[model samples]
Target: MKHLRFLNKYFYKYKWWIIPGIFFVVISNFFGVIPAQVIGHAFNLITENIQIYRLFNGFERATVIYDIFSYSLFYFGMLVLILYLLRGLFLFFMRQTIILMSRHIEFDMKNEIYAHYQKLSLGFYRRNNTGDLMNRATEDVNRVRMYVGPAIMYTINTAVLFILVIYAMFSVNVTLALWCLLPLPVLVLIIYFVNTLINQKSEQIQEQLSKLSSFVQERFSGIRVIKSYVREDYTKEIFAAESQGYKDNAMGLVKVQALFYPTMLLLVGLSTILTVYIGGIQVIDGAITPGNIAEFIVYVNQLTFPVTMLGWVTTLIQRASASQKRINEFLQLKPDITSKNTESARLKGNIKFEHVNFTYPDTGIQALRDVSFEIGQGQFIAIIGRTGSGKSTLANLIMRMYDIDSGNITVDGNPLKGLNLNNYRNQIGFVPQEVFLFSDTIKNNIAFGLDQVTDEEVSTAAKNAAVYHNIVDFEHKFETMLGERGITLSGGQKQRVSIARALIKEPALLVFDDCLSAVDTRTEEEILRNLSKIMKDKTSILIAHRISTIKNADKIIVLDQGKIIEQGNHEQLLQQNGAYAEMYQNQLLEEENQSL
Candidate 1:
């Protein structure tokens, strides 16, 4: 119920449709209940006339009874036909308006979740699993749609029909009506008790489903590792365990429902029996006519179905409530990163990091500590470091992937925080260590960032990255569709394609975070030579572990333990005989040994 309040805006948005849909529901119930009264009246009219006919002559009585019977049947049949027809029409409109509106709201909700995900920072993704997020966006959203659609429709139908039928019963005989409603308070109490259990069970079922989804998603993504390790049977066992957990939770919910629905029906049955007893006594005393008993029975039957349906409606509400709580938790999250100032400006190549320090969230390990550096416009700078030396973290900061703990990063003398995030990011080209390509055409993958790009531009970028020959050798050239995560390409080929993706942007600042790790030294050199020509008038930051890769840069910075240890060219570092020189000698020896 609390979760439903989050949807008030959507209800308001579609009120034009929803309000009319509710009207149709009410009118449909009116038609549906009216038939019971008609049947009762037809019986009453026949019974009353039969008593009258007994007093007349044989021929007169026979003709009068026949005429009354025929007219009564004809009138009852016509009323039923008209009422049912109207009921069907309104039911159709109700579904068209309300049910369809729920579908539209579901679409809007999914898109909104995706849009919010885009705004969230990298830290959020690190904390949440892909499958769990996907479940919230898909399965949880569907459950909420049920709440807005069938659940709401049935609830309104049951409520309105209950009111009408109770009014009808009261009109017939107040005492009989009160007797029939005696079990109602007990029924309400039962519903209230079962509701708590249903909500708890539903929440458990949804959580288990999320866990199962996450397990399956992780297994599929790491299938290669599972196969390589020959752990298929072991993985199957793990999956079975997860599946059984979900099944057990679902069964628990089913058991609660099994108890809930039957109890409601039993209570409704008791009410009917009570109605028959009280109404029979009234008829025997001649205080009310037989027609009153007949109408009361008809109205009681009408109430029975809806009262039973109340249990099902409650089930829908509880399930949807559980799912809505999950979705609301995500929707309410505010991203730590926000573009507060909208003053947009194009970036220049100069970048300065002043007293920057950052620690990874959740784990208080310092990834960077008072790190400071400056790159002049169009300067080619290189960063070399051991693993976990904060090299990649530095590049991430320049990209503003994470806000610094204490520092100011400026581009062209303007603070990074003050600039429009999108405008600032648009000017930078980044090729991360782990390259990711969409399941799209080679050309589309390379031109992914651009709104409109010419084929010639794509070809030129591919050629610059030294992947043009590989593309041409493929059956479809640039139009070749890649497999998931570019699995169709070799490691080096994927790296080169990623490089081409960034190169096509022709950004003012280009950061290659160990992007050439997969390519051989000879091929890496060739690519670097090509990049040097393109980056002559652009700022380039190359982060890598290989000394040979950054030996020829205008400036080289060596980091150790999140702090800069050495800063100089390759020859200058060798002259100093520091950590960089030691690493270079060690790598050179490893290459020589491998050759032997």
Candidate 2:
């Protein structure tokens, strides 16, 4: 129960529903209990051992209304009839109330979790799977709903049944009641031990289940690649191992639950046998009437059923506890990058990195070391470096993907730490190396968060990306549905669509991290020409390997081994005959040889 504190706010928000649910549960239990007691009275009357005139408490002496048989039959039948109808109606209400509360809370919690994921920085995603996080939002929340819903109903039903049954037994005869309760201590001890086992085993089962889900999702998403590489058997081996682990864990829980019902029956059987034997002696001695014994036995059986349900409820609660802990751990995690300030929209694209050093957390190798650079507003700059030379790391730093180990990054002459992170991010646009699109129409993907953008604006952005003509050629044009990750589109088309997405934002700072790598040289040249014209006044950072891509840039920074070895315009670096000069010469010679 203490593990459920993470849901405190959600519970408070929906107490209106929860309160009504509790009321319905209590009322429903009342209807449920009354029928059981009435049944006991009916049994005594069927044997002609108790008089119908004394139905309530045997307090009346005058029998004027009806004969014993007729009166007992009608009164007892009406009691059962009313109880059954009312019980069904109340149960219907209870089901509606609990479902409403559960679904409402589930909706709110899933929304909250999704909103929190949005608030988290990119570094959080680097260490987690998209599918697993999605499970927490979808499956785990529903599991929690089940726990809150039926757990509440059964908990109330269990408590109410125990109290009502105990009261009914004592009312019949105190000595018989005492004997009926004698097995309670042993039953409780067995239940406690069984519940402990169920809790422990159920937790392991849920963990293994999550692992199985993650394995299947990942493998299916990459199934084509596995087939291409001919790793089918290898993948199957891994999947089978994961699936078997889930089976073993689940079976362990089954074994624990299997023992629970039998132990419960044994306790109930012992109590029943003792009740019949002791009450038989009391009847023979004329200490108590046989009708009383019959009534007491029926109430005892009613009590045992709810107690049996606890075994299953115990299993669910324990499984729920395990799931809650995983979800709570995720919710409680602090992002790698966070801003403490409250100001909004303060960034102006003036970025400065001063003697910054960084190393990946898991691997101790420095990704960027003592790197220093600055860019003024509206300046178009290019970053050029060989593979593994930390070119991408600089682009990542602008978005604060990984924090620097030392020194500072300032935007618009103010430290980035003092600006609201979300506000700052909204002012920047990025086109990543890998192009990804959702399984939605092209129009929604382009307009994304710009609610007020017209179709004209989307068309203009797409035209600038050099993909508008290609899209218009499709049967659906801009309304065409793209497959997941834009699998339906060609490689160059996907890259251009991603570029169009970034262009649509019209951000003050636009960073292209290898955006033109997929297209041929001719297409790349045309796209860069268009981008250069449109972004003349906007601050832009282009990360590329082709010298032709960044030759006309206002500034070019060359990096090698996590340090900037050269910085200049294209002509200035060409004259130096240094690192940039060698790269330019090799590309020029390669093209010249191809033409020959």
Candidate 3:
């Protein structure tokens, strides 16, 4: 239960309901004892040939035996009715309280977990499986909910039933009651073994289930590639293997569960037989009244039933423990980045990189080594590099996705580490290579960062990105639902929308990391032309694969193996006849051949 301590704060909030819930359980327990005593008394009246009317207190002697029998039946019926009513009250309050508690915990846990994910450094996400993380937050939280709700209710039921039934039995006949309890130690030992087995099996079952879920999510998200290569059968085979593994593990769990119930029933039955056998001889010897034997039987059933359920409760608790372990592991991970900005500072457009060095979190290989650069306000700079040549790393450094190992990055000479990240990011706009658009109207996607923007402003940004006409062609125009990931839009259209989103921010600095790679040359040129028009007085960093995309930039930086090898305008680099010259010559030759 210590694993659940993190939830205590939420649980404590509803103390009012919990307190009443406990009271109801106590009242229910007291009422539950009544039925057993009445049943025992009725049995004694029937067996000892006593007047049943007199056997029930407050009932006068009756001439007709039918009247006496009816009175006895009435007494028994009332006892059962009251007990059942209290039981219902108990269940209702218990269910309501547990559900409220679980709901509170689940809601807060998800919020905290997601907030933590948002604060984590990009390197952390790069090393972890996103699908599994989602499982931990959603499915794993649900598992915790189950434990808090049903598991708690059953635990309380078992404990209350055990104590009350034991007291009732001892009050009626201590000797037979002790005889009935003789199998308890053996039953406990069996339960311990069962709990251990169940825990082990449940862990395996959950692991396989997670693997299956991750496999399914990955394949479904990449279904286009699977269909493109006509590898449907191969994909199916792989999915079948994963699915069969989950099935086998689940079946094993069923087998364990199958044995759990019957074994519990057998032990309870054995305890019952022992009580009846020992109590009968005492009755025949006239050592105890027959009513005592009947009450003893009722008490015995109450005791055995709860003890049997104890086994089932133990199983659920073990499974819950397994779930808690997974959830706790995720919660315990310390984020690589910290938001310790006790004093907020506004950002300036001037950016600087001073001998910055960085390495991938998982691999020690340096991604950026002693690289230094500076960009003042209103400069249009382009970064060109071969694959894995640290172009993206430089952009990431500015975003503070990964902290530098040495030196510093600053905005207007203010160290990034000292400034509030949220405040700093608000002054910059970032557009990534892979465009992500939510399922919403085009207007909403464009104005996502800003709370409110005029319709004129939205149209202006879309027009500048060269996507305004395309949006207007839609039947709903700005109101059209984009569908998931903007699936309803074309790839080039998605790229343009993303560009428009960045443009609308109207930030002091805009970073486009290969944002226009999808569009045709003409569209790309037009978008860039529009960007220059709007961002004439803002710092801009453009990363691109095509030389033509950045030919007219104020300056270009060529990176190779985490170091800048050249920096100049396209004309100067062309005349220098170095790495940049070679790249340009290759592009020029390819275009010339295409024209031919």
Top candidate (TM-score): 1
lDDT values, one for every candidate: 0.89, 0.81, 0.81
Write down the RMSD of candidate 3 (Cα, Å): 2.9
Q: Write the per-residue lDDT of candidate 1 for residues 270-291, one digit (tens) a residue.
A: 8778867887899898767777
Name the TM-score of candidate 2: 0.93
Clashes per model (N, Cα, C within 3 A): 0, 0, 2
**158-252 in candidate 3: lDDT tens per residue?**
67777888887777678888888887887878877877788888777777777777887888878889999999999899989988987987788
Candidate 3 segments whose C-alpha is farther than 4 A from its true place: 48-62, 342-344
Best-fitting candidate, scored by lDDT:
1
Error of 1 at 373 (Å): 1.2
Model 2: lowest-lDDT 10 consecutive positions = 56-65
**What TM-score goes with each of the models?**
0.97, 0.93, 0.94
Q: Per-residue CA lDDT of candidate 2, range 503-547, in tens?
A: 898888899998898888888888888888877778899999999
Q: Considering summed lDDT, which 10 consecutive residues are worst modelled in model 3?
A: 53-62
